[model samples]
Target: MVFKESFWTLSFDGAAAGGKGGTEIVLTRKSGEKLYLSYKLDFHCSNNEAEYEALIWGLIAAEKHSIKKIQIQGDSKLIVKQVSRQFVLKEPVLATYRTTIQRLLDKFQKFEIEHVPHSDNKFSDAFTTLGVRVDIPEEEVTIVIKKRTEPSIILENKDLPKDLREKILE
Candidate 1:
């Protein structure tokens, strides 16, 4: 069940004016033994909506990069609830975004959305606060990879050149 080569993290953040709240998002995937993908977007929208959009855009980016398995990390509890099927879609505003996310889920071999407290998502918060956006999305995200593993056979599989598998045999 090793997915991701190294660790590719994707982060998206957003903010809203007047009454809306800001949002921050992060998605991480591993590329063999290196990390190549991480994104952060800060913009304005309803708090819930912004959260949804962050997740949406993050998935779009991951798909664009051809990521097969993704573990989505977020700071909003409500967003995680909705995405993980724990809460029902009561608000109509989320319907569209939920649809978009559902489609993305179909593209990955494994997808799991986890909820972390805002404290745990400090980096993502800082990213969104650094001038959040309302209409446009930011593409400035930091992606770092550790030393490449020469014997990363899991990543060598032709079908999985982009495959990132991490495992610890007991």
Candidate 2:
């Protein structure tokens, strides 16, 4: 969805290993001319399962932020297209995930979905180890959990307008 006055901007990530999916979701909203939100989710499961799980958590996350309109970005093309109705899901497994995601999406006042290539998704990549992060209006904080990898959590205050630098500590 295109930004109008205020909209929620967020990314949902799901990674799979040994047929298990891991998920990380980041939610940001435009509040008082900047981006802020109430919550985020990062967890581990199966890749496909996490994909679906991310969408579920995404809906909850945006809802918690009081977001009426949303624009979601993800690396799963199949998930994007299936949810968008551009392509029909034929896989039995994907069909289930699609259904679950659709239920969460139905709760939104306005919603749009798109796919980003995996390489550009640093949030999900960094959350590969199953940790969660959350930011609320007037709150600067990070979710503390176990680490499974070396990726530093790039926690930023959504109220600030800034360019993202990949893997760099500034």
Candidate 3:
């Protein structure tokens, strides 16, 4: 089944600070209805890793909604370039992230990712920063707040090589 009218605009940002990380996602439907999601990372990760997590979770939400076409915007140039294949991924963990993102992209009928400046991505960035600094109750805010215990890729790939799995799970 395909959703012909289900085109969406997705924007995401992630931040890691003081051994904690968080991600925020904004999903805008073609009708202009918006959904906000904020995730607190339970484990330590780099800023780049957190960025990838935001993108991954956004894609998952789009898929759940059966969105066939999407436009994705992010402030992480490295992540956007790597996912678009304009840049090479050197780190093993990042390679895994790219691979997982590619798999998710394939599920969509059409998708495009573009790099945006931080100033242009302030909404997600600001929420993500707040999400990292304090724990907000879902009932207290309109944004949906959730926690991620581990990387989505790690949970999906059970057959991963032992060494790679260990490194990513670290």
Cand. 2 Cα-lDDT: 0.58
Residue lDDT tens for model 3, 60-140 = 888887888999999999999999999998878898889899998999999989999998987778899988998655456
Q: What is the C-alpha lDDT of each candidate?
A: 0.55, 0.58, 0.85
Clash totals for all candidate models: 25, 6, 0
Model 2: residues with Cα > 4 Å off, grouped in runs: 1-5, 31-45, 129-170
Error of 2 at 143 (Å): 5.6
* Selected candidate, larger lDDT, 1 vs 2: 2
| Winner of 1 and 2 under TM-score | 2
Better of 2 and 3 by lDDT: 3
In candidate 2, which residue pairs get closer than 3 Å at backbone N, Cα or C atoms, i.e. clash?
Answer: 20-46, 20-47, 21-45, 21-46, 21-47, 35-158
lDDT of 1 by residue, 1-170 (tens): 97434334555554445543444444554533322222222222466776766676567667767877677777778878887889999998677677767876798777777787888777777655543433332243223211111222222234642423323100
TM-score of each: 0.62, 0.62, 0.85
Q: How close is candidate 1 to the true structure, as a TM-score?
A: 0.62
